[model samples]
Target: MNPPTPSKPSPPSSSSYSSPQTLLALINNILSIVLLSSLTIKSFTGRWQVIHSKLTSLGSSLSSLSSSPHWSENPLLQSLLPSLLSTLQRLSSLSDCCSISSFSGGKLLMQSDLDMASNSLSHSLHDLDLLLRSGVLHQSNAIVLSHPGPCSSKDELSFFIRDLFTRLQIGGIECKTKALESLLQLLSDDEKSASLVAKEGNVGYLIHLLDFNNYGQNSIREHATAALSVLASANDESRKCVFEEGGLGPLLRILETGSMVLKERASAAVEAITADPENAWAVSAYGGVAVLIEACRSGSLVTQTHAVGAIRNVANVEDIKNSLAEEGAVPVLIQVLGSGATSSAQEKAASCLAILASSGEYFRALIVQQRGLQRLMHSMQEVSNSDTLEPVLRAISSLSKLDPSARLLSSSTTFIIQLGEFVKHGNVVLQQISASLLASLSISDGNKRAIGGCMGSLVKLMESPKPVGLQESAAEALVSLLTVRSNRKELVRDEKSVMRLVQMLDPKNEAVYSKKFPVMVVAATVGGGSSHGCRKRLLAAGAHHHLQRLAEMKVAGAHKALQRLSGNRIINTILGRTWRE
Candidate 1:
């Protein structure tokens, strides 16, 4: 009866049944929305924050007024109160407009910040341009990587850093020379990004900076010269870019008056440009080799290093190879290895010697005489774990064409054989060079016979889908195998033999097949004229058909094959019969 007392007012109407806890939670949520909206609007629209700040200021003023009887009595303060409170109330209402989503709110604030940053970066970049154009040092120095003022944009900040470097370089002469410290900072990095900037024109500025007239003294030139050394490590294209911009003349001039560091950079710039085949003749045109030769003789390891790389690059010109070799480069290069120099210097010399060996037979004989065989073999023997791959590739390259036959059938020949096997052991570069070395080694009768011992393996290598150079080299070695009369039958007997020979002799392939055409001509007999055993056997294998195709039409390199095929009347009859069909 007591529990039924008043029946709790029939448990209240459903609409009016909300619990005190629920009501309290709803009030708290409403208050939370109000407060969160105020915070959010203030964060996103920075201008909205000004309103918040003014509201806070108005509150402080009201608090100040309450602190003094005179403040309340003051007419000025009295009038300001209504206006201040009215403005704050308006803002509070507006704040309520922004509280729906936290995620959207965050995105909104981020967009605003980015806008501020972009605008700031733009203005800053413009100011930086003005400073650079004015050639005013203090102004330029003021616009640094640091923010001198609130920035325009966040997105372009990094681009701004790059543009500053670009402006410092491309600006008028006064502006560029004024940016020495800046240029040094940018070029100081040898990384690819920094090198991309350098390759664009940094190397040119460095060479220009070291120009004796521009620097005004050897010491200034010397400092610029040192900066150039950092630049040299950037890229081979940068050197070419510098050269194309007319940098070699100034660099060569610096080589005469600059310090060892300067001498090296000048030589390096020279080397970079001349590394391109198109520039080798230009380098020879500019007296580059003579200057590089002097630097190569320098006691400074850096000077000797770049000098060697430069001279080798310049030697790519058939025009300059003899001159480079004659200018004491060969003897000095050979000497640099034994000079107890740094490995880099020795490597540079070894590289130059390798390039020289590619040009003249004299160098080939001389290198073998100088025990280049020993040094080259030693370098090849040790494949270090260094991940710096280029040096290793370069070492392998220098040894790839050493012509071990010229070195006698000593360990180098074994090394070439081992190298051929090694070609199978690695990536594209090693395999291609290994094949190239094998082709060079397999050129003589004995060498061809030696290579013939591995013919089945070479044939296997050729069949595998490998790099073009390796395939080309294997084909070339097979061509070299044709120099021996006894080997021609075996070459003709292989199923894919004629096709490989045709591929080798194809001009469309741009391969070195002109020399092999004569061998194919010699090996191809049509049963009409030559009674040689190999010719008879080759004709027996339908080599006459391949030879008749070459001899009749001069399809690719058939001029010599034409000569041999012309003697065979039966081959002509066979060709006529085939063509008529």
Candidate 2:
């Protein structure tokens, strides 16, 4: 028999050839061929040199990856293998063509092919490096072995977050979108995840996804912005990070052009980010004030609420207040107040208007001109909860600082009755604010008589030891109320009311409450042809000692009050002279 013929070596089948081990072997083979071609090819030696270097680096990375314990199990690597293999195969074919002695392709065509191959090789190398750096391979292996479910513990959740963040950095748009959805779900379900995202410095990646050009879909941007909103709402540090990472510009862009749902989500993010006073300028600097104002005018109620809230926070910065007014926020805010939006939205609009009104008379006049007072009064009647009522009352108080607003408010019997009720029964804050508003409204004589019905409540507030501002406010309001004859008569009729005012004039109480308003109140009560019995009641209330002390200290209205109390009695004249000395 002839020597047995050696069995012909068979070509590798498709499935086996595409296996991880086979792919690694094929990559090594192609890498060697490209290196040899780079050394020998003379026509485009420079291009080949660059291509060779890239392939060498890629080959080294592939070698290291193949040596990893779970290299075959890594989904990212498995998914990437086919494209990488195709690219390497094309690179090998181009190297072979360049090395051929008798090539038909033109010199320019050959040079172009070589340049394309070099770029392909460079891209492959970059992908491999990103894969190795991403830590996804090991994370996948660990995940598979442990089979983490639902992230029961912090460590487990951290592991899960790391995987999601890894995908966010390296995954394609679709992959990133999925990761963002999962991230938003996690954030919505668990408050701690936002803090973790901020701690891990992953906020920038989410912000990067906010760009529509990068993601190419509103869904992705919506999900990412919603996630950022939760993140910003959950943690102060995250809000700072969102602003510092330039999230405001993208958010404002969304407000400008995004769909209603997307704009709502972006507005929420802006609202959260601008909650910090330091971040307010970023919103204005990015021209967000106008965008927010427009959103307030035309966005959905939810969007308007968030936009108004963001404007409220942004207006906290003194410098941005003018910008907000210049951007025509006053009318839009007034519109929101009257548009039958949710009570929360109306409250935010009221608060934002309050801030703007406090900035200067221009914003105050602008708000009043737009019928803000009417809208605010309507809101006050519509909503009864303290939270909504507080801001509305504050806005009314701010606007009432303008005489026009005060005149408008003073005419509303409903407004005066509400103030009296709030002063008597509302929480301390409401009572203080209501008392202050009464003082503001009392600038009108009609208001003083209307507010006089609340004199009993005001007197009770002054007698309370806490919140000296409330005491001062009630005193000022009483001063205005006493300018009318009926209010002064009513005060002396209630002896305790006179006692409270007299008590407020004590020198020791000066540090607790200002003595000027009380002195002014006493002067108003006794001067301008008041009854002698009222003076007797004030003298009997031990007002002489407090007024003498205040007079020595030269508190405004004190000496005049003392003289008014002294009046033409020989004993009073001698006593007043001794006190004056």
Alpha-carbon TM-score of each model against the true structure: 0.45, 0.83
Poorest 10 consecutive residues of model 1 by lDDT? 1-10
Give the alpha-carbon lDDT of every model. 0.51, 0.75
Q: After superposition, how far is residue 443 of candidate 2 from its true place, in Å?
A: 5.1
Candidate 1, residue 429: the lDDT equals 57
Best of the candidates, lDDT: 2
Which pairs of residues have clashing backbones in candidate 1?
A: 117-152, 117-153, 117-154, 118-152, 118-153, 119-152, 120-151, 120-152, 121-152, 121-153
Q: Can you give the lDDT of residue 408 in candidate 2?
A: 78
For model 2 the TM-score comes to 0.83
- Residues 1-581, candidate 2, lDDT per residue (tens digit)? 23332232232344667567777776676666656556666457677777767777886898778766666765555556666666666766666566655667788988887777677667667666766764555544543313235547876676667767766665677777777877877777777667777765377878887777875777777888888778778888777778787788988998889888889888998898888877778876787888988888888988988988998888878767878778788888888777778888878887887777777787778888888888888888888788878888888888887877777787787888788778878887789988887776645566567667678777777766677687788777777777888778878888777777787889886433567877877887887675576677787778888999999998888899898987767548655666577
Per-candidate total of colliding backbone pairs:
10, 0
lDDT, candidate 1, equals 0.51
Cα displacement (angstroms), candidate 2, residue 202, comes to 4.1
Error of 2 at 110 (Å): 5.6
